[model samples]
Target chain A: MNETATQTVVRLDRVGKTYGSGESAVHAVEDVSLELEPGKFFILMGPSGSGKTTLLMLMGCLLRPTSGVVYLFDRKVSGLGEAELPRVRRDNVGFIFQGFNLFPALTALENVEATLNLKGLRGEAARAKARDLLGHIGLAKRLHHLPEDLSGGEKQRVAVARALAGNPPIILADEPTGQLDSKTGRLIVEVLKDLAHNEGRLIFMVSHDTRILGLADRIFTIDDGHLKD
Target chain B: MVSIARKNLFHDKVRLAVALAGITFAVVLITVQVGVYLAFLANASVLIDHTEADIWITAHGLENFDFGRAFSEKKLYEVEEVPGVLWAEKYFLAFGYWKTPTGSQETVQMIGFDPETLVGAPWDIVRGNPQDVKYFNSIFYDEAETNRLGDVPIGGETEINNHRVRVVGITRGAKSFIQSPYIFTSFKNALNLSYVSKGNTVYILVKVAPGASVEAVKQRLKETVKDVDVYTSREFSKKTRDYWMINTGTGVALLSIALMGVVIGTVIVANTIYTSTTEHLKEYGTLKAVGASNWHLYKIILEQAVINSVLGFGLGMFVSYWVIQVMKRGNLQVLLPWPILAGVYVTTLLMCLGSSLLSIYKVTKIDPALVFKS
Candidate 1:
C-alpha cells in the first residue's frame, strides 16, 4: 500500500450526542474519541441501546454531535450545514443496514447503479461498474432480481456491492450480518474483510455477533453511551 | 437514475388510474362549461355575422340582436342616401306567439326582410327556395323546431299573433340564442304577424359600394340618421355578443361551474399525490440516507405529476370531442376553437404542477436516520 493510502481517514475529538434537553434528555453517545485508519477491519460490539449505532451515525455525518467535533479525510465535518453534509457523505461514506434497505422498486443491479449515479457516474459506465462490483461479491447471476425475489444472503451481498460503489474511502455497516445464517454471515464478513485489507478501505461495522470478532484487526465495546477498547 | 419517477408512478397501477381519473374529470368539466359559453355567445351574433349588410342602423340603445326595438322605416331611405351606401332595406324582428296545429302555443322570433333584396335572409335553407317567402302569408320554419312547433310539415298552416301563415320553406342552423325558434318571412308578412305597426321597422341594413370605406359610410349614417345607433357589421356583432355575455345570468353561471371544476381538480390531485408520497416515506428515507438530495426526490414527484396531467388531458379532449358531436345532433352548439383547446392544456399542466407542491414538501422533510430502524 502507498504511504498516504494507509493513513488515518477518520478522527473523533471528544464527541457527544444527546437527544432532547433539560430533565428529559437522553445521552446517546458521550465524549468518545478515536482515530480510524484505512486498510483495517474494525468492529464495535455493544448490547441493545448501547450507542454503537449513534457513534456510527456521527462518523457517517448522518447526525451532528451535541459537543466536540468530527473529521473525515483530515477535514472537519461537525460544523458543516445540513445542505453541505450530503456531498461529504456521498464522496466518502457508504452505509450498509441490517435490513438491506435496497430500493424495493429497483432490481439488484439498478440498486448499485443508483448509488453510482449519485456519485456522478451515469449510463453504461455506471452499469458496468455496478456489474463488476456485484460480480466480485458472487451476485453476478442475480443481478436482475428484486429485493423481494432474492434470498437473504443474495440481498445482503447486493447491499455490500452498493456500499462499494463510487469507491468510497469509508464503509459503515450497522449489523450487516444480523439477519443472515451462520455460513452466509461468515461469507459476508470475509467479503468485507477482503475489501478492507486488499482494497485499502476503512471498514467499520457495529454488531453484537461475536463469531466474526476473531477476523477484525481491532475491536471496541460500548456500554450505555461510553466506548472502551 | 433509471427514470425513478416513472418507475415509482407506474409501479402501482391502481393509484395511477385514480389520479388520472381525477384530472380527466376536471378537464372535461372545464372544457364543456367553456365550450357551451362560447357557443352561446356565437349564437347571439349569428344573424349579424351571416347578414350581407356592411352596416346596421338600430334604435338607440338596442341591447342585443334578440331584443329588438322598433325605429321608423323612413330610416332606410336616410341610410341609402349616404355617400358610400349602395342600397338599404328595412328589416324587422319581434317575438310573437305561434299556435301549433295541436293548439299548443309557443313563442317564436319573427324575422322580416325584403325577399327581392335578400339582405338578411335565413341561411342553410334545406327544403324550399328562400325566395318562396315572397308569397303572401308564407314563412320559413327551421327543421330543428319541429318538436316545439308540433311537427309542422311542408305547406302546413300556422297562426302567429292570430294571423294565418303557411310554411313555404324549411331552414336549418337558425336556432335562436334564447331557445326560441326563428320564423322567416317577407317584411309585409312579418308586419301582419308581429305586433309592429305598418311603416315602422326595427333596423335598416345597408351595403357599402365597392371601393368605399365602411367606417366613413357608418359615420355619415350616424350623423344623418336621428335617434338611431349606426354601427359597422363587426361592431354590431360584438355589441350583440357582449350583451348576452355580460348583461345576462347565463355567463356567470357557466364561469362559476368552470371555476369550481378547477378547485375540485386541484384538491383531488393534491390529495392523491400526498397520500402516495406518505405511503412511500420509508423509501424516501432510504434514498436520503443513501445521499440523494432534496432536489432529486422533488424531480421524481414532479415528473410523475406531469405524466398524469398529459395523459389525462389527452383523454379528456377525446371525450369532449364526442360529447360536442352528440350535443350537435340535439341542436346544441358547443364550439371548440384552437385557442380554447390550447388554453385547457396549459391550465391542466399548471393545475397538476400546483398539486405536486404538497407532495414535494412531505418528501423533503423526511429524516434520513429513519432508515436505521430495522
Candidate 2:
C-alpha cells in the first residue's frame, strides 16, 4: 500500500451515534476512532445491524456524530451545520449505495453528469467527462439506457461512474455489490480495487460479501455498534 | 441541474400528462370565469360605449344608465348653449313592456334618439337604416335578441306599452345585461310609447367642439344644467358598469364564481404536484446523498412548476380562444383582452409555484442518509 498515516483522508476521534432518546434509545455506534488513507481498498465487515452503515454515514458527513469530531482532509465537520455539510461532501466525498441508487429518470450518462452538475461543471465539458467515465467503466454503448433498462451490474457500474464524476478523493460505498450476482459483484469489486490502487484514491466500502475480503489492504469488523480490528 | 429537472418531469409520460392536465384545467377555469365577468361588465355599458356623444346629461342622482327619471327637454337647449358644447340633442330612455304577436309580454328598454344626427344610436345594424326609425311608430329591434324577443323581424309589428310599433330596422350585438331587448325609435315615438309628456327627456347627449376640452365643456354643462347630473362619456360608462357590477348582486355573484374557480384550480394543482413529488421521493433522497443541496432540489421542483404552468397556460389560452369563438356564434360577448390574458398567465405561474411549496418542503426534509439502507 502507498498509504501513510500522514496521508489520512478521513479521521474519526472517539465517534458515537445513537438513535431515538432516553430509555428507548438505540446505540447504533459506540465510541470508535479510525483513520482512512488513500491508495488502498479498506473494508468494513460486519453482520446485520452492526452499525457499519451508520459509521460510513458519519465519515461521509451525511450524519453528525453524537459525541466526537469527524475530520475530512483535516477540517472539523461534525460541528458543521446542515447547510455546510453538502459542500464538504460535494468537494471531498462520493457515495455509492447498495441498491445502485441511480436516478430512474436519467440515462446512464445523465446519471453521472448529474453529479458533475452538482459540482458546477456543465455543458459540453460535463457531457464529455460523463461519456468518458461511462466508457472507462465499459458502458459506452449503454449511455442512453435508463436505470430500468440496465442490468443490476450495469446499474451499479453507472452508480460507480457517477461517484467518480466529481473526482472526489474518498469513495464511500455501502454494499455496492450486494444486489448483483457473484460474477458481477466480483467484477465490480475489481473495478473499485483498481480505482484505489491505480488512481491513488481511498475506497472505503462496507460489505457482507466475504469473498472480496482477500483483496482488502486493511479490514475492520463491527458487532452490535462496536468496532474490532 | 435544469436538464435533470426536465428529464425527471418528463420521465413518466402519463404522470406528466396528468399534471399538465390539472394545471390546464385550472388555467381554463380561471380565465373563462374572468372573461365572462368582463364581458358582463362590457355589456352593461354597451350603448354608452357605442354612442358618439362626449357628455351625457341625466336627472340628478342618476345611478346607472339603465334607469333614469326624465328631466325637462329644456335641459338640451341649455346644454347646447354651453361655450364649448358643439351640439346637444334630447335623448330618451325608458323600460316598457312589448306585446309579441302571440300576445306574450316581454320587457324592452326603449332608446330614442334623433334620426338625423343619429347620435346615441345603435351603430351595428345588421339590416335596414337608423333613419328608418324616424317614420312614425317605426322602431329598430336588436336581431341578437331574437331568441328572447320571439323573432321581431324587419318590418314586423309589435306593441310597446300597448301602442302598435313596426320594426323598421334590425340591429346586431345590442343585447342588454338586464335580459331586456333594446327597442330603438325616434324621440317622439319613444316619448309617446312610454306615456311621458312632450316636454320631458331622460338625457341630453352633447358633443364637444373640435378644439374644445372635454373637461371644460363638462364643467360648463354642469354649470348651465339644473337638477341634472352631467358626466363625460367615459365617466358615465364607468358609473353604469360599477352600478351593475358592484351595487347589484350580479357583480358579486360573478366575482365569487371566478374566485371559486381559482381556489379549485389551486387545490387541483397542489394535489397533483404533491403527488408527483411524493412519487419521486427516493430519487430525491439519492440526489441529496450525492451531495446535492436543498436549494438544488428546490430548483428542480420549481423548474417542474414553471414548465407545467407555461405549457398549461398556452393550452388554456388556445382553448379559451375557441370558447370565445363559440360564444360569438351564439351572440354572447366574451372578451379575453390582452391584459387579462397576461394577468391569467402570471396568475397561473403564481398558482403553480404556490402549489409546489408543500412538495418543496417534503423534498427538502428528506433524509439523505436513507440511500444507504437496502
Candidate 3:
C-alpha cells in the first residue's frame, strides 16, 4: 500500500435525504459533501435529531442517497441499482451500534462467525476463522461465551472483532461506547483507533461524547442535515 | 445454520417448554380423535369379523350392514347350488331392548343363527357354554354389559320385546354402538320374537369348499342367487363400513373435522414462534450489525420450526397410542394404524413450518443499523 496516496475510500457529493411527504416532510440530511481517506479515525458529531445517524447510515451504504452520488472504490454507489447496494454494503462496510449489538444466543465466536456465514462460509472453516479473530481481540477464553456472559468491555471487543472479521474497508460505528463506563469507553476507543492507524481501516464514529474528540484525526459535524466544518 | 436455529429455541427454557407443551397438546388431540374415527369404522364390521363364511347373501336392495331387509331363506338353497359350491347358514340381525327386573333398559343387537351350522357366535365367552344358546328363547349377554347391570345372575330371565328370555352365557366385547348390549339367540327364538315365518331370515352366510377360491365362489353365488347380492367377507365388511362412513355422512364427516384440529394446532405453533422472534427483534438487528444477512436468519428460523414440528408430532403419536389402548379396553371403536399415524405426523410438521414462516420473515427483514441507533 502507498502511504499518503492510497486514494479516498469514502466520498459523498451533494448528498440530500428527505423523509416523509408534503407538510409532514423532513429533510433528514441535506447537501452534505465529504471525503474519508484510509488510515484515519473520523468523528461525525451532532446532538439528537441533527441527522448524524442518518448521515452515517448514508455513508455506510445501508441507506440510499435521495440525491447526488456516493463514491466508494470509485464505483459511484448511489447511482447503482437497488439490487447491487446490499452486495456493496456486505463486501465493503462494517457497522457497530451503541448497544454493543450481538446476537444474544450465539457465542462470541459464533457472533463473529456469522459474518463469513453471510459471506457464504460454513462449517469448521467459519468457526476456525472466527476463533482466530477472537484470539486477536484477546477474547479466546470467552469465545464460547454468549453476549450476556461477557462484560461490557468484553462485548465491545467482540463487536470490534466482528467488524474486522470480514476485512471491510470502512467501519461505521454509531456511538460504539455510549453504553460502557468511562474507563471501558476509553479502552473501546483505543481498540477502534488501532483499527484505523495500524490496520489501515477507515473508522467513522458518530457520537456527541467530548472525550472522543481529541482521539479523532478529523472531525466532521452535521447540524440540522448540512455539513458543519 | 440449523444448529443456530436450535440454539435460539433453547436460549430461553421457559419459552421453549411452553411452545413444546402447546405443540404436544395439539398432537395428542389430533391423533386420539382420528384414532377413534378409524376404530368406529372398523367396529361397524364386527359381524364380518366373526363369520367363517366367505360370502354373505343379503336382500338385493340392502344398503346397511346390520339393519337391511329380511327375506325368505329360499335364497340360501339357491346360493348353495352355485358353482364352486359352498354350504349356507341362515342368520337374523334385529335391534331390540332388554329390560332388567328393576326396569333399567339396555338396548341390544339381537343375533339369531341356525343351531346346526352355529354361524358367527361370539369369539370369546367368559361364562356358560355356546351350546347353552340352544335353550330356545335363551340369550347371551356380554361380560361388560352384565357388570354394567350390577352383575345380574346367569340363569335369570330378562324381558326382551316383553317376552321372558333366559340369560344363558356372558360374553365379552360383543356389544354394539354405545346404547346396544349384544344378545345371541337361536334362529327359532329370533323368528318367534321378530314375528317371522319359517324358511325366512335376515341373511344367508356362505362358506366355500376347502379347495375352491373364495372370490370365484362369491362370483358363482352371485350369478346363481337371483335378485340377491353375495359378497366375500372382506367385500361385505367394506360395504358395511362404507354404509356407515361414506353412504351415510355421520361418522366420516365428524372424523375428518376432528383431524383438522391438528392443523389448527400447527397454526398456533407458527404464531407463537413468529411472535417470539418479534419480541427479540433487537437481537436480529445485532445479527445484521455483525454481518449476518436476512437469508441467514431465515434459514435458522425455518429449521427451528421444523424441530418443533417433529417433536410435537412424536409426542402426539405416543399420546394417541395410549388413548387407543384405553379405548380398546373400553371396547370403543377406535383404530390407530401406522399409516394414519404417519400421515398425522407429516401434516403436523407442515403446520409447524407454515406457522414459523412469518417469524423467519420478520427476523430477516430487520436492519442491522437499528442496533447501532438504539
Question: Best DockQ goes to which candidate?
Answer: 2
**Model 2 clash number:** 0
True lDDT of residue B149, candidate 3: 47
Q: Which structure is stronger by DockQ: 1 or 3?
A: 1
- Compose the digit string of candidate 2's lDDT tens values, residues A1-229: 3443358788999999999999999999999899888888999999989899999999999899899899987789999998898888888888888888777889999989888988889888999999999999999999999999999999999999998988988899999999999999999999999999898889999999999999899999999999887
- Candidate 2 chain B worst ten-residue window by lDDT: B257-266
Native interface contacts kept by each candidate, as a fraction: 0.42, 0.59, 0.41
The residue-by-residue lDDT of candidate 1 on A104-147, one tens digit each, is 77889998998898889999999999999999999999999988
Alpha carbon lDDT at B303, candidate 3: 83
Residues B1-374, candidate 3, lDDT per residue (tens digit)?
32667777888778777777777877777777777767667667876778798888888878766775678888877777787765778888777767876787766778887666678887788888877778778888877675444466789877888878888888876756434666888877877766556668888888888899998888777666788877778888888888877878757676666666766676677767977788678767655544455766677778888888887777776776787788766656566778987887777787787787788777757764566556
Write down the lDDT that model 1 would get. 0.87
Worst 10 residues of 3 chain B by lDDT: B284-293
- Per-residue alpha-carbon lDDT of model 1 for B1-374, expressed as tens digits? 57766766777788888888888888988999899999898888888999999998899988878888987888777777789999898888989999987898999999998998887999899998878888987999888888788778779888988888898989988878898988999888888888777889998989999999999888888889899998898998998888888777788888888888788888888888898888777777766766778898888789988998998899888888888888877878787799999999889888999999998998878876676777
Stretches of candidate 3 off by over 4 Å are A1-5, A79-86, B49-63, B75-89, B96-106, B113-197, B205-239, B246-260, B289-293, B364-369
lDDT of 2 at A100: 81
Query: How many residue pairs clash in all the candidates, one count each?
Result: 0, 0, 5
Q: For model 1, give the interface RMSD.
A: 1.5
lDDT of 2 by residue, B158-192 (tens): 88898999989888788897778899999888999
How high is each candidate's TM-score? 0.87, 0.89, 0.82
Ranking 1 against 2 by lDDT, winner: 1
